[model samples]
Target: MSNDRVGFSQPQPEPDRQALGERLKEAREYMGLKQEDVAKVLGIPRSALSNIEAGVRKVDAIELARLAKLYQRPVAWFTGEDPEATSEVAKEVAHVARAAATLSQQDRQELARFANFLKSRAKAKATPDGR
Candidate 1:
């Protein structure tokens, strides 16, 4: 029964729990979700979520799935398996979101309207007659 015997399987390497925890924390913050809110949605105590973010506790598959859904990100991103997840565009989006968080409600609404206007203009340009 010794593992050293031939035909025995080697032990698998452990996942990087701390790095996963950091990604989870960053995603949660980017989504503007408080730990308590996420914990409640996951049917767990806030302390448990805190421990998970602190890398003191492991996240089960179900919790990870729920978190990915809530964060609107793929599980592969959290696991550091998505190579394009940290692209420049994503970083710029994050920066915009953080800056928008500091804006007044009226200014935020204006920003949203401007974004819609830009989208409309882009669509018009893509069309043949520029409607």
Candidate 2:
């Protein structure tokens, strides 16, 4: 009855549960979904979802995959295994750039200037001395 094998003897390591929970919470909030809504889709209790987000419960692979699909993100995002997943702003900028590709060069330049103007205005507002 000895089932111990050389390669299978090592136990798997636990994941960073808190980080995973934070990513799940961020993804859910970014998608404007309520815990009850996601729980309904996952066929789990709302309290279970809350526990997952609070890092009090471990998320199984199937649940992670389901949440990734529900949040329009890859499973690696929830696991913190993908660098691109952490850069949501970069993704948004890439999306905007792709959409702008269809416009004329002049229009693109104008759009860039407008974007710069908005950014500078916001930066100025954030400064204490209003530089």
Candidate 3:
């Protein structure tokens, strides 16, 4: 008998290992962490971290959790299941683009400067003694 039962969901596709590795690498870089430091924290060799970043090695669950904690990112982000990857973010991006398009050239330059200031301020906040 064909088991075409209701409520039987199809299996989800496997997460892309290469993409996951790329996200992990990006997070590490964003946190200003070198592979050696991250590997040392994980109690693994630097070469293993390199392999993991190159998508040549699989990260076990425990390691993934540790990496996520160190990187300050959710595991779902590395797995391409980021909660922020939603229509709301797209809408916000679109709104920003539209607003920028309407700005005069000088206003746009001022806006860009303001954005740079905000970025630098955030960086300063992240550093000890406010840079």
Candidate number achieving the greatest lDDT relative to the actual structure: 1
Model 1 per-residue lDDT at 105: 91
For model 1, residues 1-131, the per-residue Cα lDDT tens digits are 68887757533324587788889999999978899999999999999898788776889999999999998888999999998989997899889888998899999999989989999999999999989
Q: Estimate each model's TM-score.
A: 0.69, 0.57, 0.54
Clashing pairs in 2: none
Two-way TM-score contest, 1 vs 2, winner:
1
Error of 1 at 106 (Å): 5.7
lDDT on C-alpha atoms for all candidate structures: 0.87, 0.82, 0.79
Task: Name the best candidate (by TM-score).
Answer: 1
* Residue lDDT tens for model 3, 65-115: 999999766788788777684358645754675688578889989988998
Instruction: Give the lDDT of residue 41 in candidate 2.
Output: 95
Count of clashes, each model:
0, 0, 0
Better of 2 and 3 by TM-score: 2
- What is the overall TM-score of model 2 with all chains considered together? 0.57
Worst 10 residues of 2 by lDDT: 6-15
